[model samples]
Target: MQLDDLRQNWETFGAENPMWAIYTGRGRIEWDEGEFFATGDTEISEVMAVLERHGAPSGAARALDFGCGLGRLSQALAAHYETVDGVDISEPMIEGAKALARQPTGVDESRLRYHLNTKADLSIFEDESFDLVFSLITLQHMRPEFSRSYIAEFCRLVRPGGVVFFQLPTHRTTALKRLRGAAGRTMRKVRRSLLGGEPVMEMYGTPRKDVEALLTTGGLRVLDVLPDELAGPSWQSFRYLAIRPDSGD
Candidate 1:
């Protein structure tokens, strides 16, 4: 799908069922306010622990959460960093995130902020603006050209000595699954062309080699690539852990 199609689909999802769209396992009316944010805490805690093991990102002053649907991960990052910024493509999602942050139970309003960015690149934020640049289950939805550019942006946005962690599928694990994925994409294209109604969700992958080369081109040092379950059962996905080499001043 193109960027406009992605934005339209996610905007609808954000308006109708923000929480359910981010985490599909939850029912539309079933997301408990407290429990939903708590999942963010758990996820960020695990991510921080992993980073700690590698001695990453010399400081924890600021963080940026790309594609931060309703600030789920952004709010959680606030506990570790002094401030957190959440950027999303949908206006409703950003508005919902701001509203949630106003509550007493939400992350401190002063420490967390949300931004609406519909552009393909993160030009709104200056280079090396964050100690940790993160994205989760966000890149797989867009085509690789867009996703690759964002990955390069992740590398640029992170401060020297900081880390960039994101997930993307490399390919389907089985031939049947590959056929199914191709067929699904073809059907979605046909549906969009013929019906032109609600936006359909799509999945795309960048080969591992291309991803590594992109990171290298962005001047990030590949640290580790861990297999992750975020891409679902049919696809083989991985979370890349990389760091920008510190500049000797």
Candidate 2:
């Protein structure tokens, strides 16, 4: 699927089930702030632990959270970073995030912000603007072309010597699963076109070498890559921690 197609699906998904859209398995349950934000805390905590283990350079003043649905992790980030911007391509998600930010749960709402960006690239922000930028479990849902473009953008927007943490599907599914995936995508397209059903969420995987090459092309130094099996064995995932070269470079 294309970028526009992915956006449409996420917009519909966010409207219908914002929490479940962010974290599946909630299964049509109503939005519960306690449960949803707790899940976000779990993710951020785990990522922070990795960053600490690798000496990823904490003390970040400004941080960017890409594909930040409903401000779940953004709120969690407020404790570490001076300023946190939660950005998403879906307007419904951003609106829900704004409402969540106003709930007065002592999240330092002033430091946590939500932005809606529908563009293919992250041109809204300037070069070397953020101390850290992260996108988790988001780019995999996008098309390969868009995913590459954003990875390049992440490299550009991050400050020199800053850190970046992102997750990518390192390999495609097996032949049998590939066949099933293709058929599912085709049927979803047909159903959406003919029956007017909501857009179906789509996922794509990129090779590990291809992702590493993109990181290099963007002037990022690969610090480490760890296996992450979020999507099961069919689609292997990896978490990459990279650093932008010093300004002297």
Candidate 3:
């Protein structure tokens, strides 16, 4: 789908969709019984492992999940942090997230709240309000220039020595996939357009060096870059963990 059309659909369906089911699916609301992406337990486990590897704070840590569609990862984070906020640009997504909080998940729903807004501009939050900030499969939707500002904002919102985790696809592997066959090539083009172009977005793919530079330049220290293999079958995607440097550092 074209970027403009996708945005329009999100805006329209965001406010009108009952159950806000479209926010969790591929595009707009197309529900599949027991086949919801947001219900997967592996997502939560992966996120938790990423956080744990990066030394995420426990007991009184404040965390924020950017682009938290339906609050799946946010719900997981709530288990370790004292306070957790999930932010998304879609209102329907937020609604779905809120509804999930009432479920019997053995989690402290009191510590979870969903915010409807863009991560590029988090003015509603005070500076340095969170100890950890994390996002998954979301940054690709932003243009590169905008992504720089978004990362800057994430760094600004996190307290000194805090951690930030993000997962993104790379261009090289994507290009390779395109070369493999017609189906792969077609999917590649579609994904590139859905996500923004390179440098701001991870359309085709991005080199490890470029990704590290972007993170470091945005005032974060690259702590680890777990390659595709480490993430099992999802090796085409990469996970990044970085830390907000102390003021003096």
Q: Give the candidate number with the greatest TM-score.
A: 1
Clashes of each: 0, 0, 8
- Any residue pairs clashing in model 2, and if so which? none
The Cα local distance difference test for each model comes to: 0.88, 0.84, 0.66
Per-residue lDDT of candidate 1, residues 1-249 (tens digit) = 778889999999899888888887444466988889998999888888889898875344788999999888888888888898899999999999999988788878878989999999999999999888999989998999999999999998998888898989999899998999899889988988998876667878889999999999999999988898788887889989888988872
For residues 1-249, could you state the per-residue lDDT of candidate 3 as single tens digits? 344443444455455553333333345465542344344345667766776766766568888898786776787777678988998877777887788678766357779988987434778888888888888766655555555566667877888878888766554344455465346546656776698342111233445677778778767898888764322232366778888888887
TM-score to true structure, per model? 0.95, 0.93, 0.71
**What lDDT does candidate 2 reach at residue 150?**
95
Model 2 lDDT, residue 91, Cα: 90
What's the lDDT for candidate 3? Answer: 0.66
For candidate 3, what is the total of clashing residue pairs? 8
Q: Give the candidates in order of lDDT, highest first.
A: 1, 2, 3
- Highest-lDDT candidate: 1
- The total number of steric clashes, by the backbone 3 Å criterion, in model 1 comes to 0
